[model samples]
Target: MQTETLTLNGQPFYIRRWGDPALPPVLLLHGFPEYGGAWEPLARHLADRFHCIAPDQRGYGRSWAPEGVQNYAMSALVADMAALISHTGAPLTVIGHDWGAGVAYGLAMFRPELVARLIIANGVHPVPFQRALAAGGAQAEASQYINFLRRPDSHKILAANDFEKLLALFSAKMDLSWLSGELRAAYKAEWARDERLNTMIHWYRASPLQVPEPGQALTGLPDFPRDKLLVRCPHLLIWGQDDTALLPEATEGLEHYAPDLTRVTLPGVDHWLLHQTPAEVARRIKDWMP
Candidate 1:
């Protein structure tokens, strides 16, 4: 992979590229607590057929992570990616996992001209997600961690003892076989960087999505501009059925937004499937977009 820094909106955004620039581009967006390097496992499998470009998104890895909760707003996050897409040339396929999928859906909705296709793994769109989270059911209970991360002092706790708490948050009793050895050390190194723990968690604070106390509904969410939230491009949702954090109900009725949508479920896999079964994910992507 090749690395470079681009001055995006006056921020030094770092990017990793695999495969030839002349080939069709595929933008890979990673989620919170993980960097662009997180895409390496899957990118390696897709590089021969596609140009995989993964950037250390706003408050993660080597990207420009500014101070304050306002800086982490969804609009700002989407703008950062929009600039990258415009810089890289439009109509490229976008693949996102976790938080990355949020930005990918934003791009597909607001800037459809730039996205050839939309793909999400272990992620959900804001509308349905907001619905599920507000209803105060299983998904809301599963998402209590978001509220914890939003705490101003949560970073201090996570940073202690070589990020013991952060590791616990990451694992959450799921399969972490892919997180051991070299990759584990690499993630720790990124976490150890100055202000990373603090800035990365601010994303939780900036989001308007509400997670009520377990078993109680959170009402009166602000109006969502539903007309603009449609995903016009061909969309593919790859899910790990065993995912505990984001339950199926979170993305229930996703077809209403993404008219041309296809879904593939992987049994016994969880949120970290990108790392756990990247080659399988790669094969599915190739088969879809080939």
Candidate 2:
């Protein structure tokens, strides 16, 4: 893998690329509190067929972390993605997980021209997500992390004491023994490389900044074209059936947004399916990509 840093929309962003540049490109977006390295295994597997580019989105890992929460809003996140795709100069297949999945949906919703296809793991489309949150039972249960993230001092607490707790959060649901000591150590080292807690938390903080008004579902939200709202490109959705943080119900009604969606639910898997079932995930992706 080759690593480099480039300024996108005035913020310095870090990226890691694998495979031949001549091949078609696929951008992998990592979730909260994790870096691009999380996708290294999958990237290596796909390198022979696809040029895989993984970037530390905005605030996590080696990417730029601007002060204040507003800088991390969805608009800014999508802008960074556009700049990165332009910089890469490749027809892109975008894949995102968790928070990164949210950004991927935004890109498909607002900038369809940039994405050839999308593969989302463990996150619902924004429209269904907003509706689920408003429905108020299972949605609230699955989204408890949002409330935790909204706390003002949450970042300080997570980052305190040399980030012991933050490291724990990264490996919370996974069987650490399944991971090599080197990989585990690398995850801890990345969290320790910079004060990422604040920037990571900003993802949640800035959410309400652009949230729809009360009683307004994401389908009615401005900036997302309703008539042309369906994901124009092909889509593959990989969901972990046992994900506690994002319940399967969160995926309800997704077909309304992705008319050409393909789905696979892995039993006995958690939110960290990428880590727990990397090979399986890679196989599905390889088959899904045209």
Candidate 3:
């Protein structure tokens, strides 16, 4: 694998690439508070047959952290992805987890031509997400962390203690034994490099629930075209059934948005399925893709 940096939409992004450049691309997007390197093990497994490109999304790891809460909005994030695809010069099979999964959905909605296939792990479709939040039942319970992240001082507090708490959060939720000590140290080093916690907190801070536009539907944006909405490309969804952050109920009707979707539920896996079951996850992804 090799690491490189490029500017996309005026924001600097750090990307890690594996396999031959001539092959069809598989672009992986990591979730919030995590970096592109998170996909290293999985990328290694897929590199024999696919070109894997994983970028540290804006405000995470070595990537540029732009100011202002608005910079972290879904639209802007999708633009960053578009810029990445344009830079790479290839039709891509996009895969995302958590917050990255949300960005993947936005890409399919806003720039379907760039994507040939889609894979999402542990996230709900945007339309249903909006409806669930408004319905205020299980979604509210699943999303309590959103409110916690929205607090004004949350970022400062999380960063103040040298990311001790943040590291603990990962250790508690995921099986960190898969990550070698060197890799874990590297992640901690990157987390300490910038005010990443504050920048990342802006994702939740700028979300629809916190700042709704007047007269806007609870969804907060125009519904994507229904005809175009169904991801026509081959799609795969692997979910960690025990995810507390995004309940299984949230994913109940995902097929409505992805009619071609193939889904797998991991019985005992949690939100950090990538780490908890990296080999299983990678094998499933490889088998799912053409």
Please give the lDDT score for candidate 3. Answer: 0.78
Q: 1-290 in candidate 2: lDDT tens per residue? A: 99999989888899999999899999999887678988987887889999999999988888888888878888899899999998887358999999999888888878888988999988778766766666566666546657766788987777777666655555565444555577767766776666677787889988852233334334444454555667878999999887876777678888878988999988877888888788898899998877
TM-score-based ranking: 1, 2, 3
The per-residue C-alpha lDDT of model 1 at residue 118 equals: 98
Which candidate should be chosen as best, given TM-score against the real structure?
Answer: 1
lDDT tens digits by residue: candidate 1, 1-290 = 99999988889999999999999999999997899999999999999999999999988888898999999988898899889989999989999999999999999998899999999999999999989988999999999999999888999999899888888887885887788888899998887777887888888899988889888998888767667999999999999988989999989979999989999998888999998899999999888895
lDDT of 2: 0.80
Candidate 3 residue spans exceeding 4 A from truth: 168-180, 209-229
Model 1 regions more than 4 Å off: none
Candidate 3 per-residue lDDT, tens place, 56-113, comes to 8988888888878988888888899899998987468999998898888888877888
What order do you get sorting by lDDT, best first?
1, 2, 3
Question: Comparing candidate 1 with candidate 3, which one achieves the higher TM-score?
Answer: 1
**Number of the predicted model whose lDDT against the real structure is largest:** 1
Clashing pairs in 3: none
